[model samples]
Target: MKRWWIGTTAALMLIAAGCAGGTDAKSGTNRHDRHTSGQAMPAFVEQSTIPHVREAYAFAEANADQLQYIPCYCGCGSLGHESVKSCFIAGKKANGQLEYNVHGSGCEICVNVVMDAKKGIEAGKTLQEVRQQIEQKYGPQLSPTNTPAPPEGK
Candidate 1:
């Protein structure tokens, strides 16, 4: 819905003033604060007919903070992907709205990773444990993006 995108756009604008290296009040992390949320997805992803594509995009959008620390084992690093989250989001637009990456729409591995992480987290698996399992399972056979490991004890 255009209304939802407008709201999401407005929300991102509020945080646009926070520059890179600035501390984000909500997370207290020392990094560039880019907008992230389950606001609204791009039309293609929102209306995707492929099985699990829409669901995965929604999951990635909603759980970006957690997904950011998980790596994509689908060889998207060549495209400058740093983590699983990168498979769905390229970056933010100058208007502060997110720029959706089209890579995930056609990549089964990307969606599967997102869903696996989602189900695992929902089933009480910690991010670290989930990352470990994903790494062991996919790392051995697939190309990994530049995803960083989950923080210790998290």
Candidate 2:
């Protein structure tokens, strides 16, 4: 009976730990948290077929000027531009070779937009076409470099 109790206790503890994201084993975030703790974290982004990540970044950066830079109304307090990180692949570990982590940056909305845009681009959508799609999907209030708010006196 004592052995049974000990076994049950250990199992419960292990189960609890697993439930709490304790099983990160690699990146060590709360599983709930997008950011990880270690410098040598696993890749936070997924791999892309763009040949070069720079291209992907350029693609995202190009029309960034079109979207609005509103604060995340979701109360996360993050900016809309920050959501672009979801589009490109990032290395999971800081020094762990630059592979696409897919899980690192970007929110769900941003990720969906980015991935869709990427797909569209691959399917021969012009950059403008992709940007328009993003605008239509996320609204105009999501980009950053949006004409600087037309200045106060203008």
Candidate 3:
């Protein structure tokens, strides 16, 4: 009976650790934050788990004005993602504070686009120049109405 009890306790501890790992340490904010329209936004995953996601989020937050005009070719538009920035920022509050969207942490395309934009901006490229480069590379492969046909069936 003592052995069984110890095993059960260990299992419980493992489960608890898994649950705790999902929370964001920096914000410590609950996932049910209200949107401008008073709707509940989805919970965001912790960005620390993914390489470059945190940096991408930071760039998106810092350059929102320029990124707002840059289009995303990841087909997230159906999710109301107007631009690459929208994948990281859900909306702004009345006081101009940003409500971060956790979606970018899970999206490779979003992270790549943000990183590319950051590089371009650092190299002194104008917003229009960055937009042109991104569109030229990703526009043709956009998932919306442009995904390539699958290769012959396995």
Candidate 1: C-alpha RMSD to true structure equals 12.9
Q: How do all models score by TM-score? A: 0.70, 0.34, 0.61
**How many residue-pair clashes does candidate 1 contain?**
0
In order, candidate lDDTs are 0.80, 0.43, 0.70
In model 2, which regions exceed 4 Å deviation? 1-83, 86-106, 140-154
Give the top-scoring candidate (lDDT). 1
* Decoy 2 TM-score against native: 0.34
Clashing pairs in 3: none
lDDT of 3 by residue, 1-154 (tens): 9999999999999998866645444566443333343333344534245677767776777787778777777788888787888888888779767778877878888888888888988999877787778777787877432222222330
Order of candidates by TM-score, top first? 1, 3, 2
C-alpha RMSD between model 3 and the true structure: 12.9
Q: Candidate 3: TM-score?
A: 0.61
| Residue 4 miss distance in model 3 (angstroms) | 57
Q: Is candidate 1 or candidate 2 better by TM-score?
A: 1
Model 1 residue 11 distance off true place after TM-score fit, in angstroms: 35
